[model samples]
Target: MPEAVIRTAPSPTALLASLDPLLRQWLPRRRWFAGKGRPITGLTPVAVTELPSPAPDSDGAPGALTGLYHLLVRVHQPPAPGSPERPGDCYQLVIGVREVPPTRPAPGLIGHVTRGPLAGHVVYDALDDPRPAGVLLEAVRCGARVGPLRFDRDPGHEIRTGLVPRRMTAEQSNSSVVYGDRLVLKVLRRIGPGTHPDLELPLALARAGCARVPAPVGWMTAELSGDSWLLGVLQPYVQGAVDGWELALRELSKGEDFAAEARALGRATAEVHTALARALPTVTLGHRAMARIADGMSGRLAEAVRTVPALLPYAPGLRSAFTALGDLAGQGRTWTAQRVHGDLHLGQCLRSPDGEWSLIDFEGEPDRPPEERRMPQPAVRDVAGMLRSFDYAARSADTPVPGWAETCRAAYCSGYARVAGHDPRTDPVLLRAFETDKAVYEVVYESRHRPDWLPVPLAAVRRLAAPGPARLMP
Candidate 1:
């Protein structure tokens, strides 16, 4: 089959008027489109590509295109002062177009067409549009078969696919359409030239038998085409699960003792760390990496201290703690580096209905550079993250309860020590140092994004200053 000439042009209403109804159905329903909830003032098609056509249409239609087609759309919005500039805010829609017939309905395609830009364009969700879903699914499934797409961590096993494209719940950052029960296809709205951490790290962890993470089934790479698109990620669907943040809040609200559960979570995290150490090549956390981590905390602390004047009083002590930690780098008290889950907050963990915890979403902190995110760091970084979460849970409660924080901390540390074989007491100074650094990071995080939550980290900083006697574990 001759390759259709890949082309680029601005698409006006007139151009869309002549296209298939299916095309119109898809353009509006996508999450990557800027005009998701608003009217599209105008649209300019930045680029387009022709994919191999799927098998012939069942209806015997002549000259019907059945291959994957990519569209880059710039959506115009009402001008407003001080609004942050985002590609999605202007480029309202990105559609991965493909042609399919009515007879073959792709799996995972039926759902409500909620309020959004697409609702006015099409009465139903795009997956409900029979033609487009079938075309995209055929392309995804076929792409999986084309070659041995090795898992990043375990290259020995090739990726297998049985993705059925379905409409996804609305998300803020990217467009997600599930591929059957096996994988999720997340098409990024913004254009960037780096590998998405969401796709890369989870696949690496899963390949390493990090059972807590979703296994990568396949992924669609749109790099070579120069469009700066993340076609989609195919991952195993974790069934009957609740997000860990919600679960933690629920447990805390119910007056249930979470010590045992916290300990279990610690163990699960240790398992993840063990897998990471085994699967990926390790690096020593030398001066450069330590300085980078310290510098990040120091920078955020400075900004936070300035913004929330309340933090200023504690600034001197915080600076001393950070400097002491940084000084350890020169003493050769280095940590082994391994791939870590960049973002380890409660929201990133999923608890199955059976009460088992599974970590989801290996996309590290969103603000960090891709290369920095991929770089190995001390496993304790994740431990420090979870510890901070425990403190947050304690502080945000309606009434301050005695022993709640201590109990949870002990449980978590116990589980971690059991698996990682590190005694928390012996390393109390180091552990507390890392914890203080994490709290400082949160101080800035909450100040900038959620000013209301500033008290959470501020209280933590106070607690860190009053050093407590280390409790020796049996």
Candidate 2:
């Protein structure tokens, strides 16, 4: 971690100063920490706010006095290896201060200190502690406005206080707390200035009466660089919901036909896209716009090629797909562009116990900048993502299931055509290009994060680049 940039601060100086020494040690351990393997070069506080502390709630044991702090710390990463690193990422840290540490081993503990005003105090991530979680929930429920951090609640929805908060443990880039089975609060760890798409998109879908998405009931925001950056969001909890990824794996094990489920999911996706088109501004994609889109795909592919030397052979074939894209766009073909779930995959979807399919995580690709996530794109971008997900799922099984992925892919397209009035298959060029681009991205990601899974995307790259049914190579 970088050296502490601030030795002192304003309101919460005492508390902030105490945590500075431990932040570096604790941050890299969390799953949400992005700059793993890379050294953090700098650390500084961009914004800090104090949230109202509720009177300690005693559940048999003696209640300890606790202080809650909302902090936005900027973490800098060294650019080395394959790609250039972001200048830095601002992370939101919710810390709870106490005089005594937890009696048992806890992952939340920042550390015990003995050098500052908090010499004898214990600091921990507040979201992992029930006491501070209750207070944070109360703030969201009452729409408490604390300094630049404003908490707001949606109409027709109310929150209940003192519902012992339970932090969700899952493979996600954000932190989440579920309150007594009624609502779940998702805290965005890596923050970007301006309203986050996760919050902005769902609210719009809710307004459009789209039931596929869980409506936002409450949210917290802070100002960064003169624009609002979303800190956290609260929505109704999907009780007993099994995410599509798990459900698909189960089906793959059972050897059950999943084409029907895939079709229904396709229908649900179409419904969401329709609602989004009506609720948000729409634009038309001309030749120039398509050229820009192709360029972006090519750029990402180039980055992937540089990082994964294994992808170098497929680079020329991938470029051919993008080249064909520009040629098609030059033919005066224009497509409609509107808001879409920028990141759509099997993991982004959930299947409720009652047999309903719902989409989650509208944050888009967390690695991409917020501005890019907000840009209007063809709805097929999401279609291609889901299709690629199905392909990945098929390969994930111990033995690659013959025809399973193809059957589901065709069914999903047919279902989408039922509602969308146009079949995604008819536009093979766009779909192939998108799938190729997505596979390229996955190759790089898996190569970096999951070397074992790297072959999955590598197989996709070969299929997409070679002369095949789905290949778009010129």
Tell me the whole-model lDDT of each prediction, alpha carbons only: 0.59, 0.82
Residue-by-residue lDDT tens digits, candidate 1, 171-219: 6345566655555555455434467667766766767877777776555
In model 2, where is the ten-residue run with the lowest total lDDT? 1-10
Instruction: List candidate 2 stretches off by more than 4 Å.
Output: 1-17, 57-65, 80-86, 103-107, 470-474
TM-score of 2: 0.91
* Pairs clashing within candidate 1: 33-92, 33-93, 34-92, 36-117, 53-67, 75-91, 164-179, 164-180, 183-235, 342-364
The TM-score values for the models, in the order shown, are 0.68, 0.91
Measured on C-alpha atoms, candidate 2 has an lDDT of 0.82
